[model samples]
Target chain A: MTTMAERTRTTSGAPGGTRTLTLGKAVNEGLRAAMRRDDKVMLMGEDIGPLGGVFRVTDGLQAEFGEQRVVDTPLAESGIVGTAVGLAMRGYRPVCEIQFDGFVFPAFNQITTQLAKMHNRTRGAVELPVVIRIPYGGGIGAVEHHSESPEALFAHTAGLRVVSPSTPQDAYTMIQEAIACPDPVLFFEPKGRYWAKGEVDLDAEIGSSTLDAARVVRAGTDVTLVAYGPSVETALKTADALAQEGRSAEVIDLRAVSPMDTATVVTSVRRTGRCVVVHEAPVFFGAGAEIAARVTEECFYALEAPVLRVGGFHTPYPVAKHEHDYLPSVDRVLDAVDRAFAH
Target chain B: MTTTNGSNEAIPTLQLLDPEGRRVTTRGTKGYRDRAATLTAEDLRGMYRDMVLTRRFDDEATSLQRQGELALYAPSRGQEAAQVGSAYALRPRDFVFPSYREHGVLQVRGIDTVDRLRFFRGSDHGGWNPYEHNAQVYTVVIGAHALHAVGYAMGVQRDGTPLDAHDGTAVITYFGDGATSQGDVNEAMVYATVNQAPVVFFLQNNQWAISEPTTRQTRTPLYRRGEAFGMPSLRVDGNDVLAVYAATQEALERARRGEGPSFIEAFTYRMGAHTTSDDPTRYRTTDQEEVWRRRDPIDRLAALLRAEKELDDDYVAEVQQSADELGVRLRAGVRALDGGAPVSTFDDVYATPHGVVASERAWYEAYEAGDPPADQYAIAETAQGGAR
Candidate 1:
């Protein structure tokens, strides 16, 4: 399968003018584009209207779309998601925003039991194209219950498509794709990378195929580094550090976590014969573990060593002071890469 | 039993018919009585037919479970009026979100008998098309569908349908007394009232949620909980079919007029076990069950019809014959149901193709085809000797 980056390179002859946008603004623009494209698309969340969300990811949306479309629901997370299910049943595409990752437990039952299984439970008679956008991961030195990486919890559930965007371009296209898709998507916005800017072409057309495929952001042959969301940046930085040491590293950005694009990582690992998976969630039963297991099974003959993982320790996101040590850093990813090489 | 207001004034329960099946009106029930008086004998007989058929369905399902033909069955034997009466009041355009054990409503909605039992038969989670009857499949989780009903009402509000129009859509959701304590139910009431969504919360206070009594679920009347949310709320004799029908019709009409949601606490009793797997004998006294048995919903309705000369032995025999035919059909159809191929489990998981599901399905198919693994890692037969 061709990566999205490769598809973009091959398809774009004379693309629209590119503009630098923060990851948050890219998502905002993507939401706006989707709402404009379909009248059925509406956003529901607390403080998203007028307040533009805590991170300003949904800034100015309620103003552009009427209040009826961009609804500011009551201060109830389960209410937001549960009602969105109803709205979806009525032929509306609802995009809900959970304020923070830690606050998502209130809506966990609705998301998992209702939204995730509605279509399958109905035997495909009902299509709930609800996008639950959650600002996740620890960064910016936030308080307790504000910083968390709960992607694996959702990724483990069937009938849910979990995806995270590492760049503004992917965020811009993927959010729109997720809204258009008929399945319920848990769009985990990397809170740490909300302000990270990248050039996004406004006129670029993204196919649905690219929504679940991983991309080779930076290529090499010594070892493959697989990461997603906030940890993708860490993997790239680790590759740069490895380059200075004369050890090449291939960096892969796994956009979708649930229906993981394992084939791309497997291809890269088969060539490199070594692999390390990275994420900001705890190493115990994290998305990295799934990637590691898949890499080992598929690339067993090509493997020169066991696949390694770099992620959070098995503890609550520590106090703000110790978060840098708690989250996966470039150094930790490099250490995992070194371990893979040593093996 | 009477409820009290803040000033300690007694609030009478709404009742259009007494336990003896006599047409009697209380002060609070006069308006509802006038509404029920408008129904013709034909409509009354139709309701009687539905109630009798629903009870028969419940009995047949319980027998099926006893015979191991069904995995489980939740009987709707005593709450027939609470379910059938309210369902009779809905228009074709109105939607319904029913919790599990709403077999009476499903019957009124014309859900296939075999289709209704499929969930209990362990063949499928939901067995019927929701849109076909403007009713959703049974939601097993308590109080969750209340929010869905309110949300659907909100969607109706946005659809530009004239709220005052007779054809305008409304929504009704049914749950038990036990669900009133759930946070989702409270949250649903909050959303419903605040949005003024066109929905009705039909609570069947069947005296017991399994072994737990209504007292354990609430200190105040369940309708008072809806009043707390600022909706017009009332309590009714759930055994009285006319009372339930009148109350639900008024509420549905109010909803269509955009007056907002209303809550009705149908005071009834669960005369049978919660499910076939449950033993109600272990919890409640038989004396209490005997008291409710005298106030049976189907018996009261049948007596009321017989006294008014609207029902006779011929009509009763016809109804019995139809119910017997329905039971036979349910038994034959349910037993003949095929769960379909095992590989079909992977189908419809996602509307779009998914890589993980596809790969896993492929692996499963290969395994089913008896293909040997390239790298088989298995414990040797000798390892079984170490088992505890």
Candidate 2:
């Protein structure tokens, strides 16, 4: 195992200048940068102020930005978004922090209705432009509602834009970009990847990352692995493992859950002729469902099997011992991949 | 719009036009209806116009929903007088928080008719702005809108807007009788009272919650419930647009004077189903609807208008025709909703995924070779149908 400092950057990555950043540090930088540039950018959520958030992404922000900007709200999700809506209406760009993924249900109505529709209803009269910062996805050995991958719920809404960044760079850049967007955005930061560190160009404009585009993490010719938010890392590892087994794999990180980068997924499927998507949400209905449907229509002739998905089981996220089973692990991903090839 | 106040010197019940359509002069009163002498005949005519137009839009939107255009529609069929009369009384600066209903109020506030249906149609969450129309989004969660309205009124208090609107800019929240049972509504009253927020808690007691009768929502009358919270409460004949207008106008003025919150329960009936999916016959009776139908606010007002020469048979026909044309525009608007869904990627609950979701998002990418979504049809069909 290499030390954090000794970890190598992806040299064979895209021709663009490569930088290695842990998912956590990227988000931290994104927040710091957003706040540094715009005094209107404020962060508020439980444990976000002096404590730097439960996960510590906003760890040093309070001291740096002061309590007025890095606010620590009570343990109330609805209250947080509700107040933030008020603040935003007052022209303050609030970057709300939701401690856990599943904990977002309490604020679901606020996000889905008020936050999502405010712009359209107002006829763009009010651009909430508020960012709901959430640490989503499964694992972390948590309880019910705490381990949900409920991105589909937000994506199901029309007016709200939902995005998840996979890499440390994406984590950092997307946060700023999300805050800078004119519409309400639910920015899901991969909590597990918080410790993963990489380089972030302090001078880069964070909004450069399109809030609605998909990114291809790795290129392969035989099969395409599609995922987003926290699943990008797993998809990469799975791709590497598949390579050892002589199966070529392409990994696509669907950074935006709504207005899905359907073209990217279809392009890959049209070329590779096989597809396997992975998500941490229950398999019954997740982002994979949307991806599979679109691919079948656009690239039906290219598909050898029905779009295969590796996701959480039908039941609730199980206890720790069975969590590995509940989550779509590398093995499960590959198993699905194997099934796709078998077809 | 005439309000709920004694037009005559002695009687207690509010009056604008008697059932016989004659203007009964109030000998003398300080309330707004008494001040009706200050308004020219044109002001009365304009109020009538707003009430009629709002009803037209409301009826058209309902028909669109019935025709399978909107995902869901909450008809202000019988509550038009309660909503519009109050809305028309307010100045532009006054903010309003409305429950899932209030199609009439939105119209009076100058919100586009088709825009209101964007949410119920499932194409967008809301197509109107709170600031522009001075009305908040149509809150679907019962009684929750009251809290937001109260909070906004608190903001209004903080900003000195309530006290500054000398001409009477105040916050008014419209909710149904059934919503009075929600804890949020109670808490909202508490906040509004304690903070002395310049707000009006307008409860349109539309006598039913889906299939449940008003009796199910309250053991005591909703208007009296406000007195418990130290608010001046009144139960007006909601079917009378004139009464609702006068009462709401007085309340809005009082609020603007920093007089704190007031509760006005517009006693009306849910003439139509709670929503299009509702079958009043299932839990209620058509006979009950028929009884309320004769007391129709529109008819009652039209009868008065005829007696006053404010409207003739030809004018009535013209208004109905104009409403039908407006309905056509609203139908076109509903059809124009964007066909495209949003981006497909995890919005990550917030800015980031908490823990393993990161690796999971990464792992998800590893399992696939091409950009193929898993089950797009299920998402479109299920989510799309929910609003409908």
Candidate 3:
């Protein structure tokens, strides 16, 4: 694995210069840029101020901005979100950081019942332009609650736009877009990919149109592999292995889960006729299940076989030693792809 | 004034007017009484009128629910002084976050009568624009908006709204004694005190949460919970309009001065059932009801006005006429309310265009138009766009 410092080389032409940054640093820069752009944009979370958050995703923000802008809040998830709702009502955009995925349950009511429904409940007269950033997914060898993918629970609720970034560049741009968005957004950061380095264009403007749509990361015709967040990297690796096996595979990165770009998946599946949905969430009633149902509905006659899924089983995220088998890996994704072709 | 709890310990409570409607100013009530003294007879009469109108509105809403015009109704009968007085203390620019049962507060805040009934009528979740009246839509989930109030106050502080001036803005959130048990409420106090956010937590300790008594919510006096958070906390007679008004004024002033959040536990009672759906008879006794009936907020305020020579038979008749007119308007407006088109349900669910909502809306529209499932899918596909 390349160290983050080894990836920190900069290109010379652009104003700020295109630089390779870890996903976490990219998000920090994104937040920094957003704060500079709008004084109303503020950061609130536990240890988000002086300590710069546990993951250091918010490092140096409080030093640059004042304590008022980068608030270090009490250790309460519901308080973070609920108060953010108030701030949004008062015309401030508050970006809340939930330290881990599993801990988000404490604020589940605020997110789903209040933050998600405030706008609709008020007939669009009120806009809660708040962003909740949750570091999600496994692979760092952490304990139980620290490593889990709970994206499906939020995506199932209406009045919220749930999105995840698979690459450092996407993380950089999407964070800013999520802040500028007029609706409340749940931004699930793939913690496993925090140190995964990629070149990010520092001067790039946010393209709002692509923020909620799926993108075809790799194109092929033999079969289609759908994945998001951490699993996107796995899907890409699976596609590479398929190519070596003399099989062509298409890879779709589902950036947004709630307002899923299903049409893109449908269009791709029409040509490929084979689909495998992948994620780290439990397969039962997960985001993959929704994608599979939509794909089967749209491309029923065109599909060579039924839509297949590769994901965590319907059980608690197992201990670190067993997480390898529990999480959907390249091998699991490849196996599902091969099964798609078996029919 | 003081009352003994189950433990027989004396608990001080502020009351400007006793149950008999005569002025009573003990050491605990002196400062608050002085604040109430600032109001003229006209101001007192105005407060009385608001309480009367609010009670009349509650009665009408309750009757409407029984007539099947409304799906449910949460009466604000016994807690009129607590709601109206506290709301009266707020400046026009100061924001308010109220629970579902704050009909009197909504009335005092100038929320439209029809809009106030929309939630209970099931025509809309909340029909008023929060920014319009500097008041948020009614929050049904217990204690959730407490955090919002604190957060809004923090925003106000960041916005550089004056803290030491009378013009400085503040935020106040209303909840019941039952809300004290919620984690969000306690978390709100933690945030408010730590951030020193200019907010006031007005607790209408109406003595019950649906069927459960206040004892189930907390062992100590509810105001002590605020004291525990290290803020100025007080208990006031909820039936006395002057006392409630004085307490809220002091709390709001403390907040506007950037002194941080304050808590006021208005010791009131729920003269009516919690809501039209609730059966208070099952858990509470008629004897307890009889004890509180004599302490009705509206009647207490009337007696005060009568003693002060600010009210007469004609004035009472005039207020009653205004309430009767309001009842007529609410009935007409609610029945005439349109829930809007069925397809409009998909509207406003998001601020930006969402593919899922658009797709479902397209399918629904096609289904309504008698299109086949194939045609519906085609329309949905078109609605979501062919590709990114």
The global C-alpha lDDT for each of the candidates, from Candidate 1 onward, is 0.87, 0.72, 0.89
In candidate 2, position A44 carries an lDDT of 75
DockQ of 1: 0.45
Candidate 2 lDDT (Cα, whole model)?
Answer: 0.72
Model 1, residue B23: what's the lDDT? 91
Per-residue lDDT over A1-343 for candidate 3, one digit per residue giving the tens place of the 0 to 100 score: 1211221222211237689999999999889888877778899999998889999999999999999999998899999999999998888989999999988999999999999999999999888889999999999999989999999899989999999999999998889878878888899999999999999998876656778988999999989999999999999999999999999999999999988988889999999999999999999999989999988888899999899999999899999999998999888888888788899
Q: Model 3's CAPRI class?
A: medium
Among all windows of ten consecutive residues in candidate 3 chain A, which has the lowest summed lDDT?
A: A1-10
Clashes of 1: 0
DockQ of each: 0.45, 0.08, 0.65
Docking class of 2: incorrect
lDDT of 2 by residue, A1-343 (tens): 1111121111211123545666776677678867776667788788887777778788788998886687666556776677576556656778888888878887887787677766555545666768898887767777766677778888888667778888777776677767776668888877766776767665554433365678788999999999997788899999899889898899999888865767678778889999998988877778888788878877887788889988987887787667777788899898898888787
- Residue B245 miss distance in model 2 (angstroms): 5.7
Residues B1-388, candidate 1: write the lDDT tens digits: 3643223556567888888889985665668888899888999899999999999999999999999989999998899999999999999899999999899999999999999998898888899889999999999888899999988998998897887737778899999999999989999998999899999999998978888887688777678898999999989888889989999999999999988999999988888999998988888899988988998988888888999999999999999999999999999999987778898898888877777677666666667889844532121111111210
Number of clashing residue pairs, candidate 3? 0
Q: What local lDDT score does residue A268 receive in model 3, on the 0 to 100 scale?
A: 97
In candidate 1, position A162 carries an lDDT of 96
Kindly give the stretch of ten consecutive residues in candidate 3 chain B with the minimal lDDT sum.
Answer: B1-10
In model 3, which regions exceed 4 Å deviation?
A1-15, B5-7, B385-388
